[model samples]
Target chain A: MAKDNLLGGSLWDAYSNKVTTLMNNPQHQGEITEEEAAAHGNKLIVADFGAESCGDAVRLYWEINPETDVIENAKFKSFGCGTAIASSDVMTELCMGKTVDEAVKITNIDVEKALRDDPDTPAVPPQKMHCSVMAYDVIKKAAGLYKGVDAESFEEDIIVCECARVSLSTLQEVIRLNDLKTIEEITDYTKAGGFCKSCIKPGGHEEREYYLVDILADTRRQMDEEKMAAAADASMTGDFENMTLVQQIKAIDAVIDESVRQFLVMDGGNMEVIDIKNSDDNIDVYIRYLGACNGCASSTTGTLYAIESTLKEKLSQKIRVLPI
Target chain B: MQVYMDNNATTMTDPKVVEAMLPFFSERYGNPNSLHKFGTSVHLPLSKAIDQVYKGINASDGDDIVFTSCATEANNWVLQSVWIDNVLNSDKNHILTTEVEHPSILSTCKFLEEQGMKVTYLPVNDQGIVEAHTVRSFITDKTALVSIMWANNETGMIFPIQEIGEICKEKGVLFHTDGVQAVGKIPVDMQSVHVDFMSMSAHKFHGPKGIGALYIRDSQPLTPLFHGGEQMGGRRSGTLNVPGIIGMGRALELATENIEATMALIRSKRDRLEDALLEMLDDVMVVGERDNRTPNTILISVRGVEGEGMLWDLNNALIGASTGSACASEDLEANTVMLAIGADNELAHTGIRLSLSRFTTDEEVDYVIEAFTAAVKRLRAISSSYAKVGPSPGGEAQACDLLYHHDNDIVVKH
Candidate 1:
């Protein structure tokens, strides 16, 4: 690949796209009207923390803020992910300079409710309430006061969810509302995984492939090669609809073997069939090289592709070719 | 916290090395180029440092160690010196190198080829090991020099340099080995190997970058790559990168002192990681020869996933590893090393290189395995073809959406 195709334009252009969206969003800029500032007094400081990928802090910030209360000298900095960052930036403008007491009362719920009401913004994950709560906590802390008794340890209150800043309580709330069943679901609800993509998946399976129940047993049953050879030898096993899984694998293998042999033999090389393992959907085969391919740089690429492309055309889409 | 795993790219300067170099930049700053007593006094530590590096490599007393701005410069001096400067540049000029050789060698070979030199690219086996015979076969009568790497940067594959050098010597041709990645990490004795020239980069083995040495055996009267007033015993001329040179000496000494224990620790960790990852991801393939590979390095590929994406996800999780080097990331090409070892490009792209150092801890190793497993599983989830048939509902749909869309809204709810 060329450098341009790889870098996809300079990182400068990517940064520009991000900055342009930030500068454009009115909600992100917030309504910094003098009247609004005067009405809010010093209670308003914009607690602009991230939501989603930021996790607990953003949530806790939002949770602390129940309403769109203002705070004095209120500006927040966050280089958070996408819409969440923009939302936090907008939320900051919305809450600037009312008073400390007022700002502490605002919550992620209010911000999300506001986001949902705004047509331009996408659906705010129920979890984003945590971000607003985080913003509220920041305002309260900055003011050196708390409306509620300081029962939780600072570490306890400090959420670990830096992306969305969703607090422990906020995560629980979002989880309950969405009936999230897995860590993936939990991530979707609270946006704890929006940034790093660290939402733990169920189990440790490197791949999770789904098959319709009816086809699975049938595919597994077709593993025997004599049965597959019979099916491939049968003239009616067309397009693999009537063929067994083993038959399809063999058919694909036959095509690949022929193609690989043709290409390699032409190049003073030959391919060795290493191993074939049958799975429900695909047969994985590993190949070794003989002749020119043993030292050739283009052997794996050119020779393997010749094999794979030939197999892909002969077999159903399910068949895959792998190299040793 | 910012984690640095790209040590192969360049290491953070050791604070001790920094402290030692500080005075030379300030009050004690007298150019060694000067003839004054102040300059002459500075020569004591500088010469001692040079001796330290020489001692670390176990070079003979007669061997001439010449420092350069970097290993690249040193390599250029050793390689192109015989050709361009020493009157060996001709169509008959032949340079032999292993397929897994670094860009410094590869690019240099490319430049030499453009200048009409007949270059022979030696092939490495599936283990990334180049046999001695491979060099022997390429050694024509016109072969000027055979350049083979002491240790590969990506796969950490050690070559049979001594055997190659012995063969070249038998043929009466000069031999040069790039020992940049090998020097401090393993035992190297130039007196025993009897090679003409070898290049070592300070940074690759934990020294500071921008300073390296070219060990020219006493027998070879090589022409200078750079010519100027008295410097490097008139072999080359330039102001010394004093701090970088001093740092190299200290780094090499420290690394040599603990090489055995450090390698043992790395080998244990590397084996554990490889075994754990292989067990978790059953279909995954380990690259390079297990026995022949560097103890500190493990290169493995999880089938059906882009190594770059997997690496990004790992970094995002605060676990540092790479598809190859921090330098090679810009290319996004599959591992040329893996491809040379007969892995297809897809498999090569899926390759991940993990290098451990003396500084790497058991906890870090465990974290690496955990992080790698998690990230590989996650990235594999979005690799549509594999997930399509494997038994997870909606995996294909999720992977498809991830592939085609700017917004992962269909899959990631937020």
Candidate 2:
């Protein structure tokens, strides 16, 4: 019979062929008995972990060669959705030949990528992404049990995403390397704040010590400061005093557009350079406030000070920003 | 062998119903409101279809049956119209309903509550059923309406609609029932029930989708859901869905014919399937008493196995089923009926509903029983909670040998 039933199409279609096949007939679905471990002169380790969010649990069994700390055989029993079963299956397979120390290095992304039938398509749907995270956690749990330590001790770095086990340093490094501007781009790169998004902001499933929003904002700010410093060094060689009035106005406008305009625009305000006059020893740049900035109380005090200081720092030391 | 047991969601459209609707789409296609002979010729069959609906529910000529898009629209129309007619115009400002009602009724009541209406959501017992006395105790003189479902879509537990309807009639409050899951599967007599309004969907009983009707007793005064062309006696206004009405009418006619015998066959198959599952699997339970539920439905919860896991295994074997898990739902919230019935949070995610139809065969039921037993065995072996042995000694492992206590039945196996 054809499997073209009305609703059954979408349920199985959400998974790839590899995941579906592994979920049905997982190769390593049994446990490693203590007798079998004794025969091989190995240590038998059983680690059980449960996800409270979806009531899914997994028990990982490992037969590690005691002499070399190498995992000779690994198996898992998963009591969750099909995606979790397939994930645990692949996770156990990936831990087979690696040493106990090397097995701890395996991440959820590696398990999910191994389950993918194609390179581009995801192994499971987005909602089921937490299954691979469960796989990653159970490995840590098994490693922890064998090593006689807490499972969290395996993570040496400051973990930012508990769901994906992504560390703060990894998120920062990925953000800096990719020049990621949005949280979606960060998720695409590191999968931080992807599942159970309590780490993304203040109000989510739980309060977190670190949030992706703050991290992204802080990283972007640092990137901006680095760019400004490099541009300031390059602009120092260009003499503002020898340039014509048009060149002076253009330089001031460039500085304002790069630095001051973003802050003002964020507050629903803007400014335009009207003219630049070289008076006495100071270069006065006349500006007009537009939109919500027109006739504002801060236009003369705080806003004027910020514009003037930014121009002095970025363009030249003698430039004065006057709001006309 | 493809077996479909998710009739509570929707059933395969009956070929006889499809045959009845085919001509109205092309050869007999005519707007009933047109002034020409092509339009006037349709009134005979239209009235026959209306008469068939009236007979399906044992309604009288004095009553009104307004066709709508589906049962959801009919439910919304009844609640919102009562909010306008009774709550806004009169001093009555309260509505009573059960917590286990379909989202259409629950969400509409929620919208009314936001609009300053006092609504009471009565709770169900562990069997997932609402008693009639519960409805009576919540009614006050300020009550405008009492809305309840004739049967639960999840557990198939039939509510006491007759008793609740009698209480509403005595209290002088309007009573409505979402009869979407009850109409063709069971005998619904509007005359004996004292129900003022009832909503039903045709697709639930093998009719084509996108068509349903609302039964209004004595053509009672209520505001219309739509305005414009004066169709449905000005109670609901729009161009009539000619083919949908024809299909629904024929489907209901066939469903009601020899209904007891057909349901008896389906009931035996449902009972056999249920018994086989309970006897074959450990820690598996039916959600409600078989005597209390519709004859063709079973909601079973297998401990240690998630609902989606069972669905995936069964779907692979060419069997279609449904689950009460929020993970399986689009809204991603736990099943409200399971929660309202006081199931433990974990057990609530394990509910899987299988509804049989008259078209379901005995061979299909046997296949499902075998498939379901195999799925339970295969899934439980991998389950962390269904551990048959304790942890190895001195292993420092968190033992997963769990003792599940349910209804004074200790499910502890060494």
Candidate 3:
């Protein structure tokens, strides 16, 4: 059925004509037998993959000439929505006549783009993007079956930058060793996040478990802690009471940032130092709670004890913490 | 043969209604609030339209009907105002409703809960029917209002609103029903049922869009949702939509005039389609009982085939249908009615609703039955689960044969 013939109204307008055609009459919707492969001097592989989110599944059939390493024929049977069927059809079409290695390189983007009637318009809606991803997965499954290996083994390393083949450990080491701060700096040094940029953060074309933005932030925080630890060691000798108020505050802030802030932030709470005053014989530190810490009952008891004990151990033994 | 089976979403405006509304838009265009003769001339038709609405619902002359933009506005007005007058001003602070209500009521109840009101969303049974006893059990001393829909838009299961209304009356609590799907499809007599408020949308019946009415029982206290002009006697204040009012008035009149005869024809056609589909397909079940639901609705679930997949096949055949509620179609989530009826996750996604209207013909129904059956067979043959499970006990062997052939064919050769 063509797009103009659809009577379901604007909902059908979301799909391109090519997708609608393939969804209704998929060109490669069938299976290949082992006997057929043997007669042609080829190896047949069948692999099935299912999507847990929508219960959609697809089975890919490939007949590859092992001697030439070229895929002789490709077919697929999809058990999902129309988008999934169209995606699998285009994916199977793209796999034929290519080598086994080349077939594995066909990404979900290629499948989605091939299904589009025009180069600019999307073949399916955004919510249906996962169907093309499912198609891409089944190809890897079929290729893995023929190669006698796990489908996940195709990507042997955690390649953070797929375009440059940069691994996660390589990106982390580069950031730490060279003190790279911004994404532009990382891109300039290694070109890890330069192409595609999906490895930079979330909300991209592909979801990455380890992004360059997070890796850089973690590495920089470790470097800051290392520097703070060195400073603490140098200042630990009995210079607490001899230091001026501003100097003492700065030293306390550094210790608090290293020891207390992370735990407070994890629990959706935080506090800031208001003032430091000398009350009679005791040095008193006044603190105000922010966010969830403001009305918490434990801010008076357990939290107060932790803050007072941390200040006593890190800075001056005579210091007392009070919440106002 | 472009068949439309998504009538619960909206209906086509009757040509008669269009003819009635044409004069108000051009020739008799006047603000009803003005004191001029042109404005005064509009009052006769406006009041006649109001009378038609009152007669359509069998309401007494003492009852009040305020026209709103749509049922969404009418529903919001009742819920929000009840929250202010009963919950905020008085000691009553609890609201009781069902889990399978339209989003207009459920979302408003959720908003009220966030504003410190206690709400209990009563669950429905496996048949998607909420028992009146469940309503009686959930009501407390602090219960302010019991809001529920007269008929579900997805399953078309008519709730026991009459019994539930009596329970609320006995308990001295206010009751409101969202009648967006029930007004013209079923008999709604306000003189018999003891409801304090009811929301109605004209488009759900054959009227034009952008017009609806909220029925308020005589002398019931309600905080005005809008505060401006004295239109609608200060209940809802805006310059009257004269054309929409005229269309709704005439639409409701035609809808109820031969409703029993028209609905009987629609019911027979709906039943023929439903029965034929159930007999032809395997692993298919209707969501609710035929007799308990409205006259023209069938929510069927086909195992091993997705709702969107079936919709695509139907659309390719020039048929228009919906998967579950049309409002939640964009998210592709499982149907809320199915989930509330204790269907598993997969079955929830398989439920498709096909609603009929007065405009539906026997030919359209027959065409849908044939098209839907063919779609099911084709979809099931390609379904991965069907291939694995084979078929249900005593299932049609032809469908299994098709599946077997589809799985074993050597279509692509080296």
Candidate 4:
């Protein structure tokens, strides 16, 4: 149900959606019903080869059918993220169909190989294969139902950080909610990339990709408007060096767009060029203000003097200029 | 629509106290500070009133009492007297107080610490009570004072002040207990233990606001809180508020006269209200050691709702109460006292303090209970996620599944 909610209200909603989607997918969904899951009879088999103890493996155990395991069950387990979770998840599935002999054969190598087929998987490490195989053996032995000799009974997953489960979903949620655009932001938010600094090194995953259809459309529209405006400017006022200050003001006023009009309207005023006069080789713009600006106390403020100075700076005086 | 449950902040002036104040405010108003026959006549009643307050607290000597504007002022005068005396000129610079004490004591200790004094904050147990032994552990030869509140304003949890006072006496340390909430509601005697000072406010027990008294033991040397024209025996300054003093004295007299009957009635109402709330709502924790609480006060934290919003709803329905400490109501960092007592963030946010008086009737109790239940339900319905976790009336349960047998079929649904 949560998976159907694409645009969630909060970041937690996004997490719920992702978790729900992972649970519903048939591959990760083990072949067992919840009613069959009994807590007492079956031995507690943990898949600790994952990232950390609290994250993916624990979540998988919570979502998976408890009754499905014949002897291997995740009463306790741990994992890191992405591949480690996929590895443990794959190990859990492989254990469901086989007896103790065939189940123990499913190692980290097999889990990693199996995860390559999953759409969520990016890359796999060779050492994770050893972790998966060792964890599987431990689970078989811990259950006490497996008739085999193994190194350890329970899976060997170490709890590095306890504050956040620091598993796959935890880091993913942190990244998504915080909008971590840089590795520094990710490290600051999750603290996963900070500690031990093993799996979370830079370039471990490619930069997230976003679709740019809106960006392209906006760029094209802006370019077209700019081209038309430039064409009009070239045709109306090609050369302004030799024109008188009055003629120059008329040329510039012709191109005064709606932006200036809207800006003046926002200030409860408007402007019209009354005269452009020359004074001692400088051009001054004389403008008649309308509405509030015409009789306003601050009329002489930059509104008139700044405009005249800016015009002089842009178009050098052909002769003396002054405001009328 | 004013629903004020911030009674600990200050109660509405009692009508009886108001009536007593009116006559003094107009006619019969003479300067108690003056030396004339009219002044003496006013002074006579004022002297009798101070004696009455002294008797109310079971003080042996009348001279031990001093009337102040309010409890905070009394507490300040009592604690700051040590500083003014310059008594600890050579040694004894440490002041010990509990972590859950009111700001009057806590902030005063902090201020004293800034003045080259050491302050040891005794930690409290989960119940917000500092053991007498803990207070002793913080005391040393240099310890100047040990100040603890008589009853917590937020939870109404009574501290073992008698035992603490004995310990302070044994250590030769001055003990100043803030008895603002305890003086009128409960029996307090300044002479019973070797307490050097204690503070009380009239409003907590039905007097007008801005009037209180400080019980200063004669055995302890005291310096005036202010220097002025020989008022309040040169211990406190400024013109005496003759009307306010008379009203406070009267309030104390009234509270003590009906203390037993008032306690029984409020205890019954409080118990019934608490029982109803706990039975109706799950995950509600009654704060403090319930058995040791004052009869008229109940501090509870309701899960899955904001206390401020719940208080607003209760106020709309004319039910008065407070959340956290009345002084800390505006702060959202969660009650520091609640946190000091080991309450979680959720409990701190949802804490509601219900303090009743003799005026709380049986009908008001039932109305409050009903209003509280309705408010919790209403707030929960509007919350972002909790609305999904609880079963509304006519809805299925939220926790787990149930099975039903229908004719020839069986069905199970979560």
| Residue-level lDDT tens digits of model 3 in B1-414 | 999999899999999999999999889998999999889999999999999999999988888999999999988998899899998899999998887888899889889988988888877887798889888888999999999999999899999989999999999999999999899998888999999999999999989999999999984778899899978988899999999999998989988888889889889999999999999988888988888999889999888777888888898889888885211254444456776775554556577889999899989988998999999988877766555422112221111100011111212111
Highest-scoring model, TM-score: 2
Q: For each model in turn, which proportion of the native inter-chain contacts is also found?
A: 0.00, 0.31, 0.20, 0.00
lDDT of each: 0.59, 0.84, 0.81, 0.59
Candidate number achieving the greatest DockQ relative to the actual structure: 2
Q: Count the backbone clashes (under 3 Å) in each candidate.
A: 72, 0, 0, 21
TM-score for all predictions? 0.54, 0.78, 0.74, 0.53
- Which scores greater on DockQ, model 1 or model 2? 2
TM accuracy, model 1 = 0.54
Q: Which candidate is the best by lDDT?
A: 2
Q: Could you report the DockQ of all the candidates, in the order they appear?
A: 0.01, 0.19, 0.13, 0.02
Error of 1 at B294 (Å): 1.9
After superposition, candidate 4 runs with Cα above 4 Å error = A1-324, B1-6, B86-88, B325-331, B384-414
Q: Sort the candidates on DockQ, descending order.
A: 2, 3, 4, 1
Off by over 4 Å in 2: A1-9, A51-54, A156-324, B86-94, B110-119, B140-143, B389-414
Model 2 lDDT tens row, B1-414: 999999999999999999999999989898999999889888889989998999999998999999999999999999999999999999999998887899999899889988999888887888898888878888999999999999999999999998998899899989999999999999889999999999999999999999999999998887999998999888889999999999999999999988899888899999999998888888878888888788889999888888888898899899999998655654235677877776565656688899999999999989999998889889888877676433443333433222222222212121
Worst window of 10 by summed lDDT in candidate 1 chain A: A202-211
TM-score of chain B of each: 0.89, 0.93, 0.92, 0.89
lDDT of 4 by residue, A1-324 (tens): 377556533211222232223222324422222333434444323222222111112222212233553444432222222223334445656666454545555554455455453546422332123224333433444333223333334324422222111444454455455545555565577654442233332212111121122222344455556656664564467555445444566565754332344656678987777676555654555567788777766567655544544444454534222323
Which is the better candidate, 1 or 2, if ranked by lDDT? 2
Candidate 4 lDDT at B200 equals 89
RMSD in order of candidates: 23.9, 9.3, 12.7, 20.5
Give the per-residue lDDT digits (tens) of candidate 1, residues A1-324.
687577454311232232235423323322233344446442222222222111111211211232543344433333222233334555555555544455445555454444453545433332223334444444444433333333132334444354355555565556445545455555666666453222222111111122112122333344345456666656364655346655555655576566557777787987766665667777566677788878688866765666766766665455455665
Docking class of 4: incorrect
Question: How much is the lDDT of residue B193 in candidate 2?
Answer: 92
